[model samples]
Target: MRAVQVTEFGGPEVLTPVELPEPEPRDGQVLIAVDHIGVNYADTHQAENSYLAPSKLPLVPGGEVVGRTADGSRVVALLNGGGYAEKAVARQDWAFPVPDEVDDLTALSFIVQGSTAWLLLRRSAHLAEGESVVVHAAAGGVGSIAVQLAKAWGAGRVIATASSAAKRELALELGADVAVDSRAEDMTATLLEANGGKPVDIVLDMTGGSTTDGSIKALAPFGRLAFYGMASREQPKPVELRNLLGHSTTIAGMWLPHVFTLPGNVFGEAMADLFALATAGEIRAVAGGEYGLSEARAAHEALRARGTTGKLMLDPKR
Candidate 1:
């Protein structure tokens, strides 16, 4: 089996390709012949050893995969690591069947970005109908899906923030009411103006640090900000207690591993719902680029530079 492993964490260059023995599935696990792998910002973190989660050296850094079993069942999976390989084992519950209409790359997106968008909006934030929402990093993997899911979940107005013109356009094409530059000097101003000169009811924040501060400022009275990944990888800026207290604002943090580790099958249920949406043509995975296993470094660089408009993928067989 061929895999990309970071023997010593440093930079994207450390994601070197190597030959490795295929992993066997454990009692409650399934071994997948990976067809497509989703390249997430977390992969960049794992490559740099900056991710908050525990990790060890000689790590294969990938968390989402789309593949088929020996029985020919196409499934998407969420793994702790080792998804950069052609064959990887994952917990049985972590694997969800991919609909016939969904391709390998799209199925890969369903596990990570898709579930994140679905769970964060539908469950964590409890986004209600007719609520005005704002999505940070709105053209990236989770954010791109979120822009659509927010509207599908009944958000009346969805404003998107991105660093590039292409991403902003992609966000709007995905159904955002407005799109603005996240790198703008006055993010709150642009976001507010886009929202018809009003604060947003729900803010989906991906990059932490300064972006989080802007999210805090952009919330409406009694609004919620669902914080997920810190794509910026900067030390998080503390949210002033007064900020939340002033408008009855709430800052909610989410980590998918934590959700999957919870008592019941919250992860499984969410994927089911997301797939149903895909089947109904409500939500989808917008593919940005596809790379071979050896091109893992390029994928990470692209993700870090925030140049992609949708999900980036790694194909071990490529």
Candidate 2:
């Protein structure tokens, strides 16, 4: 099996392809012949040795994959690492059967980003029908999914923020009622106006630093701000506790791995619901680009340069 490894974290140049022995599955685990592997911002963080969790050196940096089990059944799996390979071993419980209706790359792209968007809209923020939502990085993997999920969930107004005009237009195409350049002055004001001069009921914030602070100010009373990703590379700023004095605003963080730690049935139920949504065409995974396993380095570089719009994948069999 060929895999991309980061022997020492630094930059995309560190992701070198190498041939490795195939992995065997243990009891309660399944071995997947990886067809497509999803690449995310998390992968770049891992490559640069800047992830929230400490990563071991010489690591194969991938978190989500779509492939088949030994019996040749299609499935998608979430892993701690090693997804950028031709083969991977995953816990049986962590793997979800891919529906015949979903293609391999689409299924792989949905596992991480789709699930996170589902959880954020349905669980974390408790998004309500006809309420308004504001999502950052609306052209990226999770952002694109978040926009669609927000609309499907019946959000009356969905405002998306992106860095460029092209990305802003893409966000609008993905179901955002309005798109704003977060880098512009008075972005919060623009977002509020887009929502009919009312503060949003929920904010799905991926960019931290100053943007997080601004998002807090843009929330409605009793609103929830779900802080999930930190793409801005800015140190977290202090929130004015006084800002919440008259408001019932709350800040929460989310990690998908925590879902696995829930009681057995809970994890299964949520994933099943996610799959159902995908199968029903209520949500679509955006696979931005595809590359062969050997081109993993180029994929990372694209992601690092913010050159891609949606989810990126590596086709291991190519």
Candidate 3:
């Protein structure tokens, strides 16, 4: 098997393709012949050794994969690591059947980003119908899905924040009621103006640092801010306690692992629901780019440069 491995933590240059023995699935696990592997910001963090989770060196870096199980059933699987390989093992509990209508790349894109958006809206923020939501990085993988999910959930107004004009246009095409360029002026001001000077009820905050502060300011009284990722490249600023004092707003941190660990078949039900949405065309996977396994370094570079929008994939068959 060919896999991208990090012998040591560094940059995109540190990711190198190497041959490894094929892995066998243990009990209660499934062996997948990987077709498409989703590249996430988490992958970059792991490659740089800045990930919040502990990691071992000489690691194969990937979290989500869309492929086939031993019985040749198409499926999407989440892994702790080792997804960068041509073949990987995934716990059966962490795997979901891919609908016949969902192609490999598309299925792969939705499993991670779609699930994150779905969980954030339905669980973390407890988003209500007719409530307004502001999605940061609206052109990126998770942001695009978040925008669609917010619209599907009947948000009164979906305001998207993007860095470029192209990205803003893309967001508008994807059901965003309004789009703002977060790089210019103040994001909160733009969001308020777009919403007729009304604060948003929820904020899907993927960009941290100063943007987190602005997001907190843009919330309506009792609004929820679900912080998921840190794409701003700025260290997180200390949040003022008073920001939430009178408003009764809440700042909740969301990590998918927590949601997947919920008791009594919660994770299975959520995955099944997301798969149904994909089958119904209510939600989708936006695969922005696909690269061959050997081009792993280039994929990392593209993500690091922030030059790509939507989900990126590695095709082992390519």
Flag regions of model 1 displaced more than 4 Å: none
- Candidate 1 total steric clashes: 0
Off by over 4 Å in 2: none
CA displacement after TM-score superposition, residue 271 of candidate 1 (Å): 0.9
Task: Put down candidate 2 lDDT per residue, 49-69, tens digits, no spaces.
Answer: 888888898799898888888
Over 7-126, each residue of candidate 1 has an lDDT whose tens digit, in order, gives: 887888888899999998889999999988888888887778777786798788899888888788888888989999999888888888888987876787778888888888977788
Report how far off residue 14 is in candidate 2 (Å): 0.9
- In candidate 2, clashing pairs total 0
Number of clashing residue pairs in every model?
Answer: 0, 0, 0
Q: Looking at model 3, how many pairs of residues clash?
A: 0
Off by over 4 Å in 3: none
What is candidate 1's CA lDDT for residue 123?
Answer: 71
Q: Please provide, for model 3 over 1-318, each residue's C-alpha lDDT reduced to its tens digit, 9 standing for 90 to 100.
A: 898889999889999989999988889989999988989988998998887897788899999898888788988999989999899999998888877877876677667777788888888899999999999988889899899888887999999988889989999998999998878567678778888999889999878887887778888998999999887667667767886788888988888888756778766776777777777888776667999988989998998887788999998876
TM-score of 1: 0.96
* Ten-residue stretch with the least lDDT total in model 1: 230-239
